[model samples]
Target: MTDQQTVTYGIDGMTCDHCVMSVDEAFRELPGVTDVRVDLVAGGRSTATVTSTGPLDHDAVDAAIDEAGYTLVAR
Candidate 1:
């Protein structure tokens, strides 16, 4: 079995439960992503923890965040 790894990213513009859901769904679609958790902070930076079978693609993650209408600031 592949070893699972976790990555944390700082998100911008997440202010509610809906924002959490959007970010969660976006990361979940990435290849090998096993789980996603977001700590939503209103009007401030939030965080997303992503678990995957291995390292994920940075561009793909960025695109997913952009598609979800949020910005991935740092990893």
Candidate 2:
């Protein structure tokens, strides 16, 4: 089986493509992250799907999301 792991995070304050890029960039900076996708739910909660090689560091994930000027919530 592949070692790839995926996790989705609920986020707030992402209103457009620029926000998506910001979050994507922040997540990509994290260790082990292979890919990042953001589902824009403008004016409501959004989802960011993250692909990585192994278990993620939740704190780092949280920080990255925050760095993107968003809030991370339960998905």
RMSD of each: 0.8, 1.5
lDDT agreement of model 1 with the native: 0.93
For candidate 2, what is the lDDT?
A: 0.91
Best model per TM-score: 1
| TM-score of candidate 1 against the unseen true structure | 0.95
Over 4 Å off, model 2: none
* lDDT digits (tens) for residues 31-55 of candidate 1: 9999898998899999999999999
Model 1 — which ten-residue stretch has the worst lDDT?
A: 33-42
The pairs that clash in candidate 2 are none
Q: Candidate 1 — which pairs collide?
A: none
Candidate 2 lDDT, tens digit per residue, 1-75?
558999999999999999999999999999989988889999999999999999888999899889879999986
List TM-score per model, in order: 0.95, 0.92
